[model samples]
Target: MEDSVFSLIRTKYNTLSPTQKNVADYILSNSEKVILLSIGELAQFCDTSETTVIRFLRKLKYDSYQVFRVKIAQELSGETTDSIYEEIGTDDDIADIKRKVIQLTISSINDLNNLLDEKQLAFFTEAIVSGGKAIFIGVGSSGIIAADAYHKFLRLGIDASFSSDSHIMSIACAHARKQDLVVAFSHSGESRDILESVELAKEGGAKIAAITSYPNSSLSKSSDIVLLSSSRETKYRSDAMISRIIQLVIIDTLYVSTVLKLGSEGIKRLHKSRLAVAKKKT
Candidate 1:
């Protein structure tokens, strides 16, 4: 319910009637208090009627307000503790945790399938496949994405580097040449260091790609390509876990597509690199 509902609204926000859009925007922006608001309260806050809210819920597959509220409450508390598979009298049932995780992953896949644009994806694949070199920049948990992207590109026979440090990324970008590509990872797309790296790469005549939650964010606007991901927030867990998982999935897809686009040459290079790297281990 947390992200499945939000992603539905995001994908269809442009197509929604004004009233429905109002409800959607309000819900997305004020997600923390959604469980606390009654249907009428949400309608009042969103400047829409109860009908619009109900229709919105129905579109998200909720049978009624009560049902939706129960789900939201459970999500807020980190999932239900009163299930048959759950330990009795616990704050959270093990099955509930597993269900939430599975649901979040499923929602991510659905969001990616529905939201990814074929033309844009193809363009990005071509850019990456043809680029001379690639640099990945990320901070905090997003740094894991940068490192993973670096390895994926390396496996594809592309020369790629990653920097978790802001200063190091700037230095790398300063020397980046045309045909080089820079990719930035940020959950909110507002990370200042990642933005700076994109700017530096642009100044150095390098193409840029951004993986982020907000398509309208600064990082997205500054980049040559933007890959979108959804982040689900539960009360007990930060959005980073969901965001990172989605980021890795998108990166994996890009890696596979890059290999496909490069044909046999790419495959050969991949094998050579693996064997060469493995030799060092032996």
Candidate 2:
């Protein structure tokens, strides 16, 4: 099934320019009305020009305003899930908290499906499979994700390295070669250290892939490939909480895809690794 227009708008909202955001805000709030209005009328309602509206639609990859409106109309006609962000209340009990967390997590995962481009995912998987070495870098919570990715790749017998320290990351990236792939994780995609390391990797002719929430971020701009995650932050829940889950899922997806592409060789290596780890057990 095609993604809901509302979901797409919310996922790509952070990447929109100010004028584009104005167009998005109007369509989101007035989705039903938007389907009825002409593109020029919608532009007028948002206090923007036809060209601005066209640009906004283009950003969403809508072929034309008519197609964009049809999608909204179709979504409006269907049974829609209310996935709006709800803040956790101080008075909420354990059951309430559990339900809210699970609901939001599920909603965010659904958004990830809607926002992620399959072609980009395939490209990233191919890069990992073909690259001579893989280096993962992130800071803070993102660093934890990088470490997890490194662990997964190691199990698959891929030559991979990960470092949370900025200096170590910089040094590692300095040695990156043309056949290397540097995977950087960041929710905001504006981490200074991550960007610095990415720059070094670029200088050394390494390919950069960013798994981040913001598509318009500096990291995304520098990346040879980008895999986007979608989630909403609330008063109590930070972007890390839900986005971490999504990032891990993305990593797992890539790992599995790489294994599939590697065929029997991949299975044999995975089996050997498992037996080696089992030998360490009591």
Candidate achieving the largest lDDT: 2
lDDT for every model? 0.77, 0.87
In candidate 1, the residue pairs with backbone N, CA or C atoms under 3 Å apart (3 or more residues apart, or in different chains) clash, namely: none
- Please identify model 2 stretches exceeding 4 Å from their true place: 18-78, 82-85, 89-93
Q: How many residue-pair clashes does candidate 2 contain? A: 0
* Alpha-carbon TM-score of each model against the true structure: 0.73, 0.81
Error of 2 at 105 (Å): 1.3
Error of 1 at 127 (Å): 1.1
User: Candidate 1 lDDT, tens digit per residue, 1-282?
Assistant: 345445565555534677887787676656668778999999999988899888887767677887777665665466322111111233768877777667656665667765676776787788887757888889999998889999888887787888999999999998888898888899989999888878888998998888887777899889888888865545666666777888888888888888889999899989988888896784
Question: What local lDDT does model 2 show for residue 29?
Answer: 63
Cα deviation of 88 in candidate 1 (Å)?
Answer: 17
Report the lDDT of model 1 for residue 86: 15
Q: Which ten residues in a row have the lowest lDDT in candidate 1?
A: 80-89
Q: Please name the candidate that would achieve the greatest TM-score relative to the true structure.
A: 2
